[model samples]
Target chain A: MILEGKKRLWAEYQKEIPDDNYFYVRSCIRQNFFPASEPTFLRILRDELKKDIFETPFHTTCSGIGYHSDIVPMETTMTVVARQFALMTEAGYENYAASCITSFGLYSEIIETWKHFPEVLAKVRKHLKQATGREFEIPQSLVHASDIVFKLRNEIAAKAKFKLVNKHTGKPLKVVEHIGCHYSKMFPSKGVGGAEYPYVLVGMIEVWGGEVVDYPERRHCCGYGFRHYLVKANRGYSVANTKKKFDSMEPYKPDMIITNCPGCPYFLDRWQYVIAEMEGKTYGGDGQGIPALTYEEVAGLVLGYNPWDLGLQVHQIAVEPLLDKIGIGYDPEAKYKGPNGEDLGKPEMPMSIRCC
Target chain B: MGKLYDMLVEDVRFQEGMKSCMNCGTCTAICPAAEFYRYDPRQVIDTVQTKDEEAIEDLLKSETIWYCGECMSCVTRCPRKNAVGLVIVALRSLSQKLGYFVESEKGRQQLALKRTIGAWILEHGYCVYPRKITVENHPEAGTIWKWEQDNLDLIHKRLGSNLDGEGNGGLRRIPQESLDELQRIFDVTGGSDFYNQIEEASKKKAEEMGLSLDEYVKFVYTTNNGLHGRDEE
Candidate 1:
């Protein structure tokens, strides 16, 4: 997040990198939709971690992109996406990671679909054999980025360097973690330590020394439409969905909010502003936006990372007050202002929980 | 306005929708989709009545689209007896028809579902079914693929839909006959093409995604996408 968005996390500082083989597979949606986080994560990985990870531009967005939209036709999505992953494994990178939880789930589905439908397997295999002239194999392991964050929280805390002070409010933030649905819904057993009580992002917040608040609907979504809400005419539903989290989080009054999946951040942060307007709150963000956060951005900020470095400045709802409260201060002078000299509001990029 | 307008419109047999909702928020409270999707079925009902298209558009950009598990938990629980689950499908249908379906990462996830579901329907003549007797039971079949099959009979038995010759005019159905009837219904309902395309595209998707179609197809329970596969980079 410090660099941009969920490209790669904890890679920038990693010195002893895995050399054998790793999957560079990412969701096209993440790369293109949520590029800001991607650059930051990649920086941490390549510049800091010193690991060898690669990408194939040919990789298409996991049809997971359209899975919720009820378009793209499921048959095409499964076969093509499965073949793509098989190509990666065959090329020697068996392990895969996705910035988007749904992408990870979709990847999991591809495998499950194969086992359930020999026709799908046969078709994918036949096509691959004919086109690539090589056989494909589904790797034994694939996981979400948050899964690793929680797994390596202890190690990450030990390497911490900077301490964050709020830029304006001057408060030390104690955050709560919000994990996306896909991460826990797809492969409950292998992905998160606790699908019932996933501790990936929440545990990492704890590792970062941030207090994790428990809200009533803490596990709820950011109200992102699998399809754009407008086209589907589900605005009120979308807004209400977004409001549930804010309404839940507002009571706790934590210094800040944190999450792993990019999509989760959109609602956690952006939706607040919208809800503020609907609920008629005066303290709504500059644009009346909501909280904007990602696990990497949250982790990077508390560990002495800057907002600009963490890409916090791009948020529609200003985090200036948030930083002040959390003890992670961005210089007040650079307070992100919107077009009217108010807060810049949130960035207008399509954010997601997937990696490109 | 899109090809999908007529594609699956005739097939959407949902009698209850959010329009009938009275804003009880009860559906929102218990909705699994609302839990993750942030979509309040109550709100969906309100928006439809208000015709708040712009706000609805904003909702489309959210992750809620993927939040609905289509569990229908809100159907009867709703005071208005509305099922926003079906409305979500309607929203998805609209999103798909408009190129706007590609707005968020969740939208992108939809691209693969058609094929996955299509192949399932083509082979088994159903999209998804009851959850029991999945791959979890057969270790050799790989746990993830074990969840693909849905046991309607088991579910019917559980739901008491089984009219065993004595109950409600003996609504019992012969296996093949029922399937043929379903096919006929689907054809009139515009579901046949929807199903056909799912299989067609799933074949290609499996290959591209490196999924083991062979293992998944033969596996007893296969619809679940493995969960918790997030990346850090």
Candidate 2:
């Protein structure tokens, strides 16, 4: 009966695909770190998958980072979310998809708050109307971009040119999926499989023929604790939190780490470099650190997108090793090419490599 | 009897974060911040549960309130379903609102945060824009960022982002209408008041220290309490 209940929950995890139209709100961190991921997602949706996605600069940041950092108050954050919804209402898109997991979670929280307290929603509506002279209707469906990919994973896998398997060993690549803390920790019902076992990224990994590696500390925060990361005095907490996860997951020997959150991919990937430089220790199978990529980037790779075009070069830990393991061919020489196909050349000195 | 404890307990955050505290150490045991700092969520909860006005006021002015990473790990682990994270949030709100935030080392960093992140939203529409992340402050961004800055237009164009351009896709320039609307929202929702509060408190602290507000903010941004140190370069 427990197994049957689990099967029923898994079946309910999938949501209706919002292919008619989606208003995509870009993430602040995703754009800053992996600048190409959003563009790649647009390509996959518009060109490859043929889905209509509306992206705009008019939709501002969700103010989540600042709110969580304690500078922006809850009222301010909710008001900002209301404004974003107004923009969506103006554009007539009912399905709201956010590129950042933080924003996604914030949106979910704001909506839940409104559901529980109609007065709060009415007040925000009043504030938004007073501020912008614009009103909004709540979106019919709200989801993170990863949720959209998870919904369409079967389609993505069916069209994929490559599988997530080791070329020599002919074995499925062991992939570790890290769900961002905000994704489900706060509101389990809003997530794919709820907080304890979020299947957002794992769904994608499974469909792509990769084995999911379950390690301890899998549910830990990405250490993007808003203030912990921002305040210089508190960054040790951030590093230590991430180090704990690496220590737990290193024993699993995963080929690559996949994440649903924008900050998670950046922090998980960047901290490997910081950890190695500070501790003289590396985590992956070959003594190199495990490469981390967002689910969107990983999906793009499985669909045979070029690495450089997907902004893989910007990563602190190189994705080249993962690519080599999967037998994806690309010229390493032309990694950092300009818009006109002119070579920008790689960094003369690599920041951190395996040095023990 | 609107004492500090009374004021705090009346807050919705405090109400939501606290239940019958069974004096369990589960919160601290699961806290990532507690592992690294002198912070103890259990103790924080215990302190508030005492309902001592003096202790509550001291908490508002101390480093302990600022130590929570707000990951909500404590919220998940507490058998009583207490969210010490939310209580810390309430404490912080009170700290900033009452100007008690200027009394501690970590508390003073609120000014730095307000200037960079809080102000950025009102001005640029994005929290951590590329242009705002200076090469000096964020060397961890590595050389690619520097190169990206140098060739901003070309790189963004390659990535298919309109960037500063006015229009449909990519990080196009935020239209003035949208920016104006954002400012109005901040003004209406007390966000502007919060910013003013941080500025006013920091300004008073700066005056007390015989330094300008600008100098004071720079000091807060650059210095730490000789613990949990970061790259000095």
Which candidate leads in lDDT? 2
Tens-digit lDDT string for candidate 2 (A1-356): 69988778677444555655999899888877778888888888888889988876688888988988889987888889988988899988999999888898778777976886777789888988888888998999988888888888898998998899999899999999998887877667778887767888888998898999998788878787887777665677778888999999887888999988888887887677777767767887555778899887898899998887887877767678889889999877667777888766555343456411
Model 2, B1-233: lDDT tens digits are 43887778656567767788988899898887877777778888888888888888899999889888887777767889788888998899989999999999889999989998888888878887777878676655555567777777777777777777887666667788888888888889999999999999999999998989989888887677666423222
Which stretches in model 1 have alpha-carbon errors above 4 Å? A1-21, A32-34, A128-134, A163-172, A228-232, A282-290, A326-356, B1-29, B32-233
lDDT of 1 by residue, B178-207 (tens): 344333433433345654443444445456
Query: What's the distance in Å from true for residue A267, model 1?
Result: 2.3
DockQ of each: 0.04, 0.60
How close to the true structure is residue A175 of candidate 2, measured as C-alpha lDDT?
95
The C-alpha local distance difference test score for the whole of candidate 2 amounts to 0.82
Model 1 scores a TM of 0.56
Per-residue error (Å), model 1, residue A13: 28
- Two-chain DockQ for model 2: 0.60
